[model samples]
Target: MKEFRMAIINLTSSIDRCHNRLDDLDSRLKKIEQRDLEDQPNISGLVATIDHLKSELNVRDQELLANDVEITGISETKEENPHHIVIAVATKLGLTLEDRNIVSVKRVGTTRGYIEGELRPRPRPLVLRLVRRSQRDDLLRAARVRRHLSTVDMGLPGDTTRFYLNERLTYSNRQLFFKTREASARLKWKFSWTRDGKIFVRREHGAASHRIRNEADLQKIFGINEVGAKE
Candidate 1:
């Protein structure tokens, strides 16, 4: 009977210890949950603040790029002059341009490195800044109408290089534009295009066009969480 009583006492003690341990774990779990709950609003507020800042930055970038256009596929010449190239392109597009109307013209990338056996490197795009917004708009519209500007058209008849002109977008806007295009393609959207450094997507013909300024805008347009989240 003494041994049996001792055994019973030990079992009760073990049970009490287990209950204490369980209670301790439960208390810790509750504290963790409460902490998460308390932190949620702060996290949300921080995100909201960040989003507002991004919007402001994007607006500023657009303003900075308002009078610029990007021209691609013009072969880099030995004595490259971006101003001359712009004049050549304008002539090809049949738009009369005065030198004063051009604010600046520049190649967008580093010079090519020489490699003897390899094929000649492709040329970088040119960023052309015009003095007036109307000039930029007219140039873009004319280019779109032709839709087949090439180096051959610009006096490189022996070469088969093609060229394209687009609105000059900021680096961030460029990334978002590319991702929005990819996402639109995946979802079979009808159209995706840029205007004044801003991205717009339309789901179908005659449907509402959605402006995708950031990741959240894209998410809302596609009805998904963080589509192109990597960008």
Candidate 2:
């Protein structure tokens, strides 16, 4: 009979110890949850700060390209001189270009191999960095005025292909511009263009131009979400 009572007491003590441990565990869990809740706003603030810094960096990077121009659709050839091509284009535009005014000129990206029974791979873009910002601007303005400048006009042999010249944009701005154009078309916006490495959009004829600096600007001006634009 004594042994039976001792056994019952031991069982009750064990149950009490388990209850205390469970209470301690539950208290620790609640503290951890509270810490996470307190830290959520700080985490969000840090993320915003990081995003702002990145945007500032991109703007600085774009500023460096102020004197650079990008030319696309110009066919490439072996043993071709890019400098001569730039000068020829300038001559066609009625603007005299001296070698001293040109800082650097080269083709960008890798040249792709030719495929049989298919058109030749598109030529990589040519990036020209001029000595002065005004010179770059003048060249681009001339190219815009002569919108139909062709390879043949530059004395290149073969089928006459249209080439385009415009200001060089940073990779981020380029992606944003592409997205803006896509959204503009879908939303039926009238026109979109880039100037001085900044993207602009017009809703209709005689509408105010909206400057789009980032994705948020896109959302604010065009009602576009991160996923895609929506009216």
Candidate closest to the true structure, highest lDDT: 2
Instruction: State every prediction's TM-score relative to the real structure.
Output: 0.77, 0.83
Q: Per-residue lDDT of 55-164 in model 2, one digit per residue for the tens?
A: 99999999999999998877887777999988887888889999999999999988877768858877889899999999999999998888788877567654578888
- Residues 162-199 of candidate 1: C-alpha lDDT, one tens digit per residue: 89989998888888998898888877898999987778
Worst 10 residues of 1 by lDDT: 151-160
Clashing pairs in 2: none
The superposed Cα distance between candidate 2 and the true structure at residue 81, in angstroms, equals 0.8
- What is the TM-score (0 to 1) of candidate 1? 0.77
The residue-level lDDT of candidate 1 at 134 comes to 95
lDDT of 2: 0.89
